[model samples]
Target: MILLPTINRSVLLVIPKQPFYDWSNKLFPDLEPTNMADIDEYNSYLLEDELFIDDPKGELKSYWKKIFLNELYEQCMDETTFPALSWKLFTQWFDFHRSAVVSDLTSDPLYTDE
Candidate 1:
């Protein structure tokens, strides 16, 4: 879902753990399950967009999750560190970056949930 940037852990939790690998070559002829060596794809896949809601205070959690996801994406970019980390990397990342995470995102056009 390229349109959504909700990094809320709950939302991501419900997402298929391995959307790329879970895809069947036969089902999605255009998107066959293959190793994603592309940098752009990896970034978009791992990082969720900032979250905002009608109420300014409501979207805090979503923004926090987004930050955590972004951190995980950065770690994955490093081949040395990424090789050892598995799909559960998000767990470690969320715990590690939990402090820095905040719910500051709110109706910001810069981080459109596109």
Candidate 2:
């Protein structure tokens, strides 16, 4: 699992181990997801990019754009392999991130009970 720390919270990218190379290519084509240390380094690069500029305002749309690309979706839809499992895992991961964003928004100081 790769832990991606965003502006508001951390996201865990759970890539299946059986097809490690295949999933690695699909999820992280530019870098390798070897361990937490590597993923942490990669996360630094992501945080520095312009896509994360609006992260503090509760806008993390870029993450979804990066994760749910057409090619990745098609790869997950391959019928001869673990299509259902892949789809399920992707959705679960996405749901967790989405929930985290919502939680962050709701718990912000503007809406806090303090």
Candidate 3:
């Protein structure tokens, strides 16, 4: 059997909170609103391996804008409809789970379209 592949990146899993759904609903009233418990899926971003080596919170803060905008874009394509975002609102809108170590369990080779 082939050995497991090595992945040097860390991971950040972002799960939307109630306020996110509230914002989405406000933008598109016709669409169904979602809740934290009802949502089973989330996005995981692979970050630098040294993310937590020093000043982890600061590192995370730097990446928040990109991550936050990605989450909003997934919910609604219309950028104009999204609310003005701040660091405080970003933290309030989602729950984040960070892992310094990421394991690649698959034996198959990994590919990226990019």
Candidate 4:
């Protein structure tokens, strides 16, 4: 069972123990597989800038955005693994940075709309 707090209420999600264990193991291979703390910590890392800074050309950032969207889609398939706030944080950052990148290019005279 996992508890998530929303704006107006708290949600409780229950998962079968065996499947939860398996999913947890796949998500967190280095730690004790069933621990929510480990999952939270892993999610926290996804919010870090370092995760998208490896590629000099910024392709890795776009790649990670797709990966995160895919993860969000998978999580939506099961409430028990749905990490709503974490997904929001990732997408908010991704969208903001992506737009900033576009703006930087468009702001130049060579790429102007007019």
Candidate 5:
């Protein structure tokens, strides 16, 4: 068995819940709808571990807006189709699953576009 490399990163899985699917369907009824069974295919964001050290719960708030926008953009690039977003709406639309620790299994060096 291969050992995974330890990385100083945390994970946040962004999953679109039923409300999100309903809204998407309302916009484009002809398009194939997203089902709960396919939720595992959603996005996973890797963030620095330090971001969660102080207040694991509240610290992520500062980044939520960007994350939310990214998720919305992934679904539909047209910003005009998106509803007015707020903390409450974000919570209602998506489910956030967080992991305090992450292990990078690859031996190759990591890189990011940004």
Candidate 6:
């Protein structure tokens, strides 16, 4: 969908593996289902447990965190890609960082008081 005008200004129209962000409601309301609740639920998709996937500390990189992070930054900052690629990166990073903040939050502690 990235190649589509709906995705960005770039005619090349390339969608990365992960959307990295979701403004479909703001960007395209017409795409929503007819039901309002469905739209609300869909809007909440980003905050749901499954969508918060992250490779904390670069374990996926086989202990090479720096190289993996560099690649992630490049994936996020390729100025040659779209006109707003940098903006996309910024927003994505913000979402990731913000999620990291709340990820540890819990109503109940793992260790309970007797």
Best by lDDT: 3
Candidate 3 residues 36-111, lDDT tens each?
Answer: 7788988999898847736545788778889889999988899888778787888899888888887788677768
- In TM-score terms, candidate 3 sits at 0.85
Alpha-carbon RMSD of each model: 14.3, 13.9, 2.6, 18.2, 2.6, 18.2
CA lDDT of every candidate? 0.35, 0.38, 0.83, 0.37, 0.79, 0.30
Where model 2 places Cα greater than 4 Å from the true spot, the runs are 1-22, 25-33, 41-66, 70-86, 91-95, 99-114
TM-score of each: 0.21, 0.22, 0.85, 0.23, 0.82, 0.18
Per-residue lDDT over 1-114 for candidate 5, one digit per residue giving the tens place of the 0 to 100 score: 967677888888888888887877777888888776666688888887845535534777777888889988887888999999888888888888778777776778989887
Clashing pairs in 6: 3-13
Candidate 1 TM-score, C-alpha based: 0.21
Rank all candidate structures by their TM-score, best first, as comma-separated numbers. Answer: 3, 5, 4, 2, 1, 6
Which candidate, 1 or 2, would have the higher TM-score against the true structure? 2
Output the better candidate (4/5) by TM-score.
Answer: 5
Q: After TM-score superposition, what is the CA distance of residue 29 in candidate 1 from its true location, in Å?
A: 3.7
lDDT of 4 by residue, 1-114 (tens): 944321221121122233334654666577665644334322211232223333423534444445554545544455456444343444343322321111122332433253
Native-to-model Cα distance after best TM-score fit, residue 98 in candidate 6, in Å: 10
Model 4's alpha-carbon lDDT is 0.37
Candidate 5 residue pairs in backbone clash: none
- Give the count of colliding residue pairs in each prediction: 1, 0, 0, 0, 0, 1
Number of residue pairs clashing in candidate 2, backbone atoms closer than 3 angstroms, sequence gap of 3 or more or interchain: 0
| Candidate 6, 10-102: lDDT as tens digits | 111112222422322233455642332232221111122222235433322332233224434543444343334343353343332213122
